[model samples]
Target: MTDKASNSLLAKLGNQLHKNKLVKAGEILLLFIFTYTFIKLIMPLAGDNPLLIQAVVWTANILMLIYVWIGLKLRGESWKDFGLVFGSISLRSAVKVTLLSLLVFVLAIAGFIIGSVIMANITGIPEGANMSGYDYLKGNIWMLIITLAGVYIVSSFGEEVIYRGFLINRISQIGNDSKKATIIAVILSSIIFGLIHYAWGPMGIVQTGFMGLALGISYIKLKKRLWILVLAHAYMDTILMAQLYMASN
Candidate 1:
């Protein structure tokens, strides 16, 4: 197919997102999942070049954001439709978001700790997330800086865009914007958010899933303040990276 024809087809599908939200939601979700899983599956082909792998991951993450951006544009909407206002951030709100981020950071930790306890009791297992994915940061300040950048784009910002801003909004649309729809959207989004950490292993999944629950609830309660959630996620990842860096000895 020619580029024009392909764009035409995608435009038609974008239109379906409005006319038939249920089906389109599934399609969007499958594409989202495929994007994540497929990239990870093909990652080994990139060999052991850390910079190359990081670049690929960063590109994939940015592309995911772009996909969301394009989808919104195709529907005659944009990030503004979802309350992501990056402009005009006053210091008062900045301070507020920072303080809230600390609180959310605490809640996230509590969630993981509680989840770890419950999971251990239920399964009699104690293995945690296979964080070896980040083991590359051990004693590597340069890589630490690089991974911190990834935390901002990939884990903190991009995940919020994909999971909260896009997924919650899309799923809620499937419910015709009812309160129940919002509740279900948060729950399902949290579940998917948790599952996405599958590389973390079973205990890791539970831990992250619980963390997702905390973040989802906060997102709703805070009136979908995306920046606050983004900062909160950044705070969590920052501390995690710091710990990893410190463990290098």
Candidate 2:
């Protein structure tokens, strides 16, 4: 093709990416996975310090946020477009949604436990697959505190923004926003959410997937208000970390 023709083609592709949520979503997902995978690959060289691991993980979250932010700007969107605004929902409504999300969180935990038990009975636990990061934080108050903050800020806020807010909205658009399409989007996003926790083992994957599903449903039902998911996720992580600390002590 001629130089002018190639330039026109490039411009068309850029415009399509800006106009299509699904394309933007694909770019974001690929970018996140590629960056995170590279980080994980180099983690062995970084040693096994929990603090270092935490830092690396937080870096991945920051990368994800940057990618999403750029994508939103390219599309002429704001964070509020992805349910990142507090003023969009009233305090009373936020409280109601949060309470309901907590209920879902509890049920999700129960379901995950039951699923894990059944899977263990059938196949036994996988080797080297038990929860592995907490040992580093055992009896370390400062590390525990850092971890708590990281989980709330990075895991809860960052993951909710990427998985539930971005993925669900983009994937649903891919399906033309039909009911079935939205449901499929929820499931697909949840599966990816679970896969991202592969270090947690099979049981963890299942549990996280279930939790993601619940969060995705809540996101949709609450009109994409993200505060509920963020609160629920932070509460869940807080409980888990508290339990881990208590067990260690």
Candidate 3:
């Protein structure tokens, strides 16, 4: 990077991450490493009542957002910086969000298909993500309803906030928000998104990684209207859970 570019990058990052470029990059790397390692350490304890441990992990993930919130607060920022505001929800916007969600959902599906094909070629039909984590939803009507609420709070909404809003935006900033920087952030965020689904195994990782890539791209294209991404994610979750529920019948 040129001096001007380097300066720009520093100015954008503007803090702990900004000052120490190496540390900033490593922070991202170390987070995923730590997260997965922590999960692996705890998962074995879930031999029989897996739901207990899964719930603990799920709540931990949800609570993990507090770190981001506190980081923002410490910097005199708020989630508004991450596009979690209720901005002028007019009829036009509702329609726009709906349409954009559909567009992104299509793109995500295409990404998933491509990822699936690639995984198949690499691993001879990759084993899918372990849905046993959610096996409680099978024919459990109350659980389905409760899970819907839980997912909307954690998976559909929270994951987008974590992956697209926080990771992409911060990573892009650390690179000075250049085109290349944005692309790198998107790719890195997508990979991490895939990794978080470690229970899915290799195939799940690749497939979700690609889907995350599509979502990341859509996030940037949509001018970071995070609600759109959340809606799109919700659509996917609804479909998956519906399928799981139906499959039991």
Q: Which candidate gets the maximum TM-score versus the true structure? A: 1
> Which of 2 and 3 is ahead in lDDT?
3
Give a tens-digit lDDT track for model 2, residues 1-249: 999998787676567766776675677568667777868686776587766776787888888878777767666678898887755767997688878778767765665565566667767763333566777666777877988988888898999998998888777877778999899999998888888888788877777777788788878887897877788788888887877777665
RMSD (Cα, Å) for all candidates, in order, is 2.7, 4.1, 6.5
- Clashes found in each candidate (C-alpha, N, C closer than 3 A): 0, 0, 1
Against the true structure, what is each candidate's TM-score? Answer: 0.88, 0.83, 0.85
Better TM-score candidate (2, 3) = 3
lDDT of each: 0.82, 0.77, 0.81
lDDT of 1 by residue, 1-249 (tens): 999999898888778878797765775676678687867886887787655665766777787888888778778787877768868878998898899878887887888898899899989987777776666788989989978987798989998888888888888888897999998988888888888788678888889878888888888888888888888899888989988887879
Distance (Å) between predicted and true CA of 122, model 3?
Answer: 2.0
lDDT of 3 at 231: 92
| Model 2 alpha-carbon drift over 4 Å, by segment | 1-14, 18-22, 88-94, 124-129
